[model samples]
Target: MFDISGREWIEEEYLRLHEQGLVQEKDVVKVIGVHNQMCERCLNQSDEWFGTFTYKEQLITYCRQCLDFKMVDNCHYLYRSLMPAKITDNAHVLNIDFKLSSLQQRASDFAKEILEANDLGLIWAVCDASV
Candidate 1:
């Protein structure tokens, strides 16, 4: 189950992955709730790794051994991922010379025209449907 779920501090995150067909369902029951988390700063800090905390009127869980780092609260969300394709690790180029698709080219041309005019530019699209 650990092999399938990978390593996540939250159990429901793995279950959520299973529901999304990202992980095997058989591994869900075998997954145990993670009651401890290594400090993001120092994993081998101490046995008293995790402790409950409070900040901004919200209760949170944090790494006690490292001055309370890597905190998570009620509003926090966790995502456990399966094996995913690796894209470019560091591709932070602002602009590149590449052949764009027709639709993308249209958007690019529109953006160029707007920028050339030096007016308030607005080019909106469904950036992400999931969110």
Candidate 2:
């Protein structure tokens, strides 16, 4: 079977995978609830970005932030495969010919720390408009 871990799909996609025998019913996991005040996919917490609609006599809530990519809402389920027991660690090397400034070096070091811990971190750097 193909590796589906670290991937998220919709209900229809999961059903297709099941029909293809790539994924079993027990292997699928629903990650979030419908009518969620916050969007689990995009982490959009703004209430104004969410909308409700009637479907089959049921009110369904959806996240607009990620709607362009896929319909993320209560009526549809976000499916994910179960994580593997052991994950292999690979060395991630940063290849830069030029030396980084002190500020950039600090950000790079911080990113490495968070990545080693398997946590989320964002390093925002604004380049000059002229560049």
Candidate 3:
């Protein structure tokens, strides 16, 4: 089996991997729960956004919010790896032509610090140039 941990895939991609023997049904993590009628992938539970259609003589519920990206439905499944993806400390290079404002610089610094420390944090920066 190929290493496909820590990632979610739609049904078509999952089936391709399964056909290559890189993944299996048992290894898939379903992205939606039938009992709850909620899409685990997008966490959408709005009844208005969900609809059913007949496919192969079976009715299938699908999430309209995530449909543009990929079809997430009741009869089908979203697949994720059972194992965690490997983490690396590889340095990432950023290439940008524009300079950041003072506020943006501070926010960027804070974000970098949190990532380097492997800590969880949120930075909110609001800008109103017209003000």
Worst lDDT run of 10 residues, candidate 3, spans 122-131
Candidate 3 lDDT over 29-82, as tens digits, reads: 866432277876677889998888898899888888667667788876677777
- The Cα error of candidate 3 at residue 98, in Å, is 5.2
**Candidate 1 collision pairs:** none
Worst 10 residues of 1 by lDDT: 26-35
- Models 1 onward score TM values of 0.28, 0.62, 0.56
Off by over 4 Å in 2: 32-35, 84-87, 94-131
lDDT by residue for model 2 (1-131), tens: 58876666788788898899988878767866344487776777898888889999998888886777678887677887786533556436558797788888788899989988998766667764221
Candidate 2 Cα deviation (angstroms), residue 29: 1.4
